[model samples]
Target: MSEVIANMSMSLDGFVADTNDGIEQVFGWYGSGDVAVPTAVEWATFRTSEASAGVLRHGLATIGALIGGRRLFDLASGWNGQHPMGVPVFIVTHQEPTDWAHPEAPFTFVTDGIESAVAKAKAAAGDKNVAVASPTVVQQCLDAGLLDAVQVDLVPVLLGQGIPFFGELAKGPVQLDGPTVVEGQGVTHLTYRVRR
Candidate 1:
């Protein structure tokens, strides 16, 4: 069987991106090296230092396919050949893409709805796990009772205001399974095993 999981890094104040959609606030807080992996030993010590492969470690370990919206899909275009999972990714979008570089990644764009996207992602995933990359899409999975777990890396900083991990939810009574904290190179990782 396969499972659907969602993961993202957020700030202590609960914002994913800056108010202007600029992640500079996020990147600035870490200050130095890659946001995914820090090179400084002290920064690593600040983090739990359990994993070293960046988000790829968790994503690849738990999922065979990744699903996200147009924004994230475009953002990942630069890493076409550097995909960590080496699996297919389904993008949920209305506009069709003209360029195709990571053709090997097996991207399927769904315009119908989240259901269609999830169905296609699962099909592509087969027996492996599927990841809902963006918060919006992740919320859809959660609303449909399709998501299995949620993992968030809680970076130590307050964003004042910005795009939150979970924006306006459709409905609530939302519950969370205990969160496990893991210190990374420059950021603290939090993993939650959400439940009903």
Candidate 2:
């Protein structure tokens, strides 16, 4: 009974990552590439209203697991197996990771395919939400008709040449429900229920 969700921060122009732009530039707002792993005080405070907290605690309390793509895995440098929420992450990849970048924070790489990875993540998620956190996996889930909802933090900047967050889905015009916009300092969080 877990709902599959795909979420990410995208520029107003609809790009998740910039063209050849490093993680620091595209995802710098989160602190660093290992933004997934929050520090001790960050955990202690548990304050959602903090000025620097951009949807920080939004779904952190609900998500039970995460699914991401290979490119996102590489770009994020594997988050060194450290995720802010301490949830298990399943990486959908054709090739396995060659390095154990983060010993303490580890990732589970699924090679079978996106569906398989999602299935595993969903099972692991119990009754909580299984978040499809990578762009490629999100598109695949949408194409495969697996995702239940899509959440995006719409950033104000326009990265014109980066990889697109969404474009030409396998099916034409994926209908969306309420934007349910939540305004913050640097970004706006938008959530949509994918109309089947």
Q: Tell me, what's the RMSD of every candidate?
A: 5.2, 4.1
Cα misplacement distance, residue 192 of candidate 1 (Å): 1.8
Model 1 clashing residue pairs (backbone): 47-183, 47-184, 48-183, 48-184, 49-183
Task: Name the best candidate (by lDDT).
Answer: 2
Tell me model 2's lDDT, rounded to 2 decimals: 0.74
lDDT of 2 by residue, 1-196 (tens): 6899888888888888787844444454565222243432343233222433646665776788999888877776676567666788898988886766665554688999888998899888888988887677888999998988998877778776788877568886788788777765565778899889
Cα lDDT, model 2, residue 137: 84
Quick one: best TM-score, which candidate? 2
Candidate-wise lDDT, in order = 0.69, 0.74
Error of 2 at 176 (Å): 1.0
Candidate 1, superposed: residue stretches over 4 Å from native: 24-58, 99-105
